[model samples]
Target chain A: MDSMLSTPRAPRIAEQAAQWLEVLQRGGAEERKAFAVWLTESRRHVEEFLFMTAVDRVLEDVDPQQRIDVEHLLTQGAGKVVPLPAERAAAVSAGVDRVEPAGMRRRSVMALTALAAGCAAVAVAAWGLLAGTGWEDYSTVAGEQRTVELEDGSLVYINTLSQLQVRFSETGRDLRLLQGEAMFSVERDPLRPFRVDTGSAVIQAVGTRFNVQRRSRQTTVSVLEGAVRISTEAQTQEEGELVAGPQQSVPDSGMLQAGEEASIVVNGRITRRPIAEVARVEAWRERRLMFRADTLQDIAESFNRYNRSPRIRIEGEQIAARRFTGVFDANDPESLVAFLGAYADLAVDESGDELVVRMK
Target chain B: MQTESSKQTDGLAGTALEKYRKDLHRFLVRRLQHAEDAADLAQEVYLRLLRVENSEWVRKPQAYLYGVAAHVVFEYRMRTEKEPVTFDSEVMEQLAENPAGVQPDELGDRLGLERQLERLLGTLPPTHLAVLLLHKRDGLSYEEVARKLQLSVHTVQKYIFQAKARIRMEWQRQEAQ
Candidate 1:
């Protein structure tokens, strides 16, 4: 080769180094011993060996998919004319129902990329998954809030203690709100209805701003800006009859307008509030938790959601029965306790793992 | 001398670096003086050992290894401008073995190597490129590559070597630029 001619002895060492790599990879004890002797001959041998191996590693790091020529050849041999991944992804989002062979192959590749050692491959595929039916699950911790921009240009403001699984099919944008609350600022698409499944019901919207909160006893839907269609799951006739004493009374799921809210219970029935009570419902966003004459125990639980240590515990029936009305910082437990002490004429005790409130 | 299995990043047990790690650590400690800095440099030496593309070049791997460690010490000196460290003549003598200083750039690190590699990989001949891809990307053994390509093992070795040589040429050329 011209390269060998340009550098005569370097090539010889290169071959020698390559041979040693081969031996090191596969050869027995005798060959390895022979290899150790060969390395003793020159300093260049080790350096060249290092050079080859490092470059090889770099090559290994890059995806074979990047080599368009090779991928083209492989695709042809498989008896298929394949479009590039980017092109196929674009077609998919443009409402093309036909799945390209390459697109399907890429889907598996994308899945493998998630689990594979090659992180870069996964990164490449992650961006393309927005167009495909690739469902991605997202969650936020107790004190953390996250905003995710969906492929359909919808923005999901994930609230604390929330888990959501999102899937974008050709016809619709699907979401399953596993727990907690999320405020969605959806982008309007006539072709697709943005839907959230909360086990009890499915809230469908063409484009709207709304919040879905899954509470301890029931799932609540509060519409802040636009109308959302609440379709509760159908309850069985026998179960309904047992609850209603041999009378089947089916409750209808309805749409909630801006400043309207609804709660869906276990039997797939809804309780509607005429007004959303927007300021009270959305107060957590401003860190200004609003409670009106709530029980001391209930208020403590609200404050505890934002605090970690020194849990709030109301002592005695007198302290627990006290009415509390205040807008306090969600994150500031000290301020809320201080407010109770000053205004409610309550004795506050900070001792040994609990913040205790007692009737003074 | 036989070394223990290495605890390096690549996780190949019983590498020469693993066996003689204490010696290498002591060597670094002597020059860097600070136990932590020496410890870091010693780990870097092991990492480099683990990353050795061709294990064959390590004939007098012990000597060749010290050569790498000695060079790392020099590079460490080139950095740490806040510290006025002196390199004795003996240390300077060993520096002659290593001439492959990475090309300088504004980013001053991996970006330069990536640029140089990209340019060089493009310039390499098809045979050399094929061998490089097979050995590096495909992670094929020389015997396997030989079998696949219908060539002798020696010829495959030559291609791998040539591929390496061509890359080195390109890197050196970048340095000259």
Candidate 2:
């Protein structure tokens, strides 16, 4: 039996559950009735519901005994969210210094595992790096761009509101995109297929260069050279179909040709289109964002990627559809918004780090 | 080594009874803040275990024993007044003055969060409370909890779920508040 069908491989359901749990936790009235209805619908729903409920329970029972060090737990986002003071004391009482070795071990293991994931498509021994460490993590706020070099010779240009974990293993290299977009310039090694894991899907290179971007719950893969195979778990080798095309929404098996762009949606739907200009697609490499005719919401979201400051606020559908185009330093999205505000017939106000924009 | 006939031996009784006695006693001592009372409840765990029919029928001895101990603690707390244990004074003194980057506007956020947690914790039933304490406070395994309660692992998990749902309701109330 295909694991996809057997498991009901619906991340949408999981996401829905998480959202409903959040809503219930946050006391959203609309979700309460919906959740109750869903819970009583089936025994399986109740079981699935209970798992997340356990997590919520763990979060609420924040132990004062564990309140020794707020910094470590809060920094790692590891423990349940508690008052800063309690967290700090817990950290101290638990002795954060004692957990350092264990934390390091976990981090190194995670780094190695990420590396192994990269080499999944290609054959490579996992022994070489003995210890994986010292890869700088770079994250851009809503609309920003920065270039970073990995331990391996490859260079990565990160796009707005994006994060990538760089791990170089003896086998090859791996990159996990926690949030945003990145363009990778690979140092070609056919023996070690460079791989990228975004939140939505995983892409393995066939000695090719490509750019992967993760937005919301969608992953966009654009191949610049050779070919890259993208797969969702739903269409993996274990499934009836070994090689899924652009039409298949499964996670483990989709192929993309050079100069082609493909996206895997949140609901496991895939769409592919031919790229008009590779340069436009990889504009972040030169610290530029060319939206052509993109929605204002997308433009604002792109700007939000650059920094926590200069928050973009759009009111209603009236101004959201307004298409934007121009060449601006992706590093400073606020300034771009300010520049656009000058003539776009949009009222813009900059207060501290927040930028509010409304149709004039 | 833990033969049925060896129950009367001082070494076996001391080692077997003392394992959870001190820990359970210590937990009770903290919650009740009365060493004598905690000590009494700890003794009750042994008494209850000894009274179980064909106690030798228990295969997982330690698990069964702890389950009995946890129930005693739960009953003891419920039967007594709720003098909720709080963070120590030294801990409280250190808690003053929020972290450096908390921002001036967020000074009262911690107080609000505490209020929220208090309301949420209040909604859970005593057994669910025991489950929370056993799982979160003591870090007991599901098997241990089930064995102690004379229930299956699924039931223990259900108790945890019930506790969580109640907390979730409290969190919802806090959000509205």
Using DockQ as the measure, the top candidate is 1
DockQ of 2: 0.03
Give the per-residue lDDT digits (tens) of candidate 1, residues A288-339.
Answer: 6788888888788777766666678888987787787888877777887788
Residue runs of model 1 more than 4 Å from their true location after superposition: A1-135, A234-251, A343-345, B1-177
Candidate 2 lDDT score at position A31: 44
lDDT of all predictions: 0.56, 0.52
Q: Give the interface RMSD of each candidate.
A: 12.6, 23.9
What lDDT tens digits, residue by residue, belong to model 1 across residues B1-177? 212111112223223333233223333323222323433554566566566667553444543565566666666866766665665656535453222231111223233444545667777665556556655544444554455456676666676667766665454445434
lDDT of 2: 0.52
Q: Score the docking of each candidate (DockQ).
A: 0.09, 0.03
Chain A only: list TM-scores of all candidates.
Answer: 0.56, 0.54
The local lDDT score (0 to 100) that residue A82 gets in candidate 1 is 30
TM-score of each: 0.40, 0.38
Model 1 has a DockQ score of 0.09
